[model samples]
Target: MASESPACNICESIISQTIQTDDRKEIQIARHTVNEHFDRLQRELLKELQIIENDKRKEISKILAPVERKEKEIDGLQISLAIIKQHASDLQTFLVSKQIEHELIDTDNLIQSIQNNSELSGVIVSLQTIGMMKSLGNISRFGQTSQSDMSLVRQKIKQAQAKVAVVTKGSLDHQHGTIKTEEGL
Candidate 1:
């Protein structure tokens, strides 16, 4: 019985050592499993963050694209406005020069008539000429334009362009015009 007791104790000690080794192995396995799961979770999170960043980049580009287009349109409008101003200035200068030439020709004709006619006939002709000159003067002044008038015209053009720009901006940003087509093809 004494020998049997010692054998039993030795068997218990061996069993306990075996259990302890198995427990250590299980702990190591558990630790490895947790580290693997954490690594997978971190990779998935990084992938999700990359996708979110890509979506935000696309959204930001969408928002700024229209602004870039509008800036280009404004540049085109400015170029057109400059051309219009130059043309208006040239036309005004040409018309004023032609008016001065016409006045000089009329004065020359009146002087020739006075020199050819006698005193009494010249007086009658002079009275008739003065009446015609007054009507011509009225006709000439009817459509006369000055620098201030040109400026007013340019101002009106600017106002009209501004209104057009607003309308254009609306159309550029969103579809507005209705489609009109034949009912049947």
Candidate 2:
């Protein structure tokens, strides 16, 4: 019985050690999985943000192109008008002046139209993270660890006891001449 106690203790210890080792392995695997998931999520989020920014930039550029073209045309017209006024005769100046006035009115009307259409309106960019933020905030811990059951250890102890009982019975039978070796000793 005293020897049996030691055997049971050894069996329980081995079982506990095995359980601890498995638990550590499981923890490591879980940590790796979580880290990979967050890493992928971060990459995806950054990609989406970049795409949005690029789209917004394109939209703003589209809005500004016509205005910029009109501004350059007006500058060129002013320079041409000045040259004509300084270098032309009265008849030529009168004709050129009429053409310049029409050009100026058209340019002014285009500018007014752009203003009225709100082409230069402000663009606002923002992230919609309320749900994500709430979900993140709700998380208190990455995971939880739990105690393993002792039923496996108990089962192992029982098997060890059965083997010990068989060995003891075999020895007792041999000593009482109820069991014999193949060759007489």
Candidate 3:
């Protein structure tokens, strides 16, 4: 009976050792499977994160579209404004120059007319007989008339010159104002 008990104890020990070894092998298989599945899950997560990043980039671009369009519009408007300002400056210059040229021509014509009138008056006075002068008009009246005509012509020339100066100054002031506006912009 004692020998049979020893043999049964030995058999129990052997079964325990075999069970532990099987348990260890099962644990290792489970660990290997978990590790492989974890790798696949990590790859899937990385792919999804990349997709999300691409989507976010697309959304950001979509949000900025209107801003980009508005920036282009503002640039176009600025260019148009510059062109308009340049054209206005050109027109103002043309008008001012033309006005000055016309005024100068008018002044020259007035002076020529005055010289012609003075010459005609002198010839008339020199050729006039005393009786004819008396019959027509007094010599003082002729002198006064010629003097008044010459004085009126001189006044007109002076007035035209002053007007030209005023016009030029006004244009210059407008040009300066335009420059200031551009600088501020």
Q: Ten consecutive residues with minimal summed lDDT in candidate 3?
A: 139-148
Q: 46, model 3: CA deviation in Å? A: 3.1
Predicted structure with the largest lDDT when compared to the true one: 2
Worst 10 residues of 1 by lDDT: 119-128
lDDT of 3 by residue, 86-148 (tens): 777877656655655555565556557656755323221122258965765653332111112
Runs off by more than 4 Å, candidate 3: 4-11, 72-185
Better of 1 and 2 by TM-score: 2
TM-score of 2: 0.67
lDDT of 3 at 137: 65
Report every candidate's CA lDDT. 0.57, 0.79, 0.61
lDDT of 2 at 182: 44
Cα TM-score of candidate 1: 0.35
The sequence of per-residue lDDT tens digits that candidate 1 reaches over residues 1-185 is: 11324544565567667766876787778779869987997798778777776876776566456556555655655555566557767776566555545545555554455457532131111113587568757763222222234445445556666677799988865552332223332
- TM-score for all predictions? 0.35, 0.67, 0.34
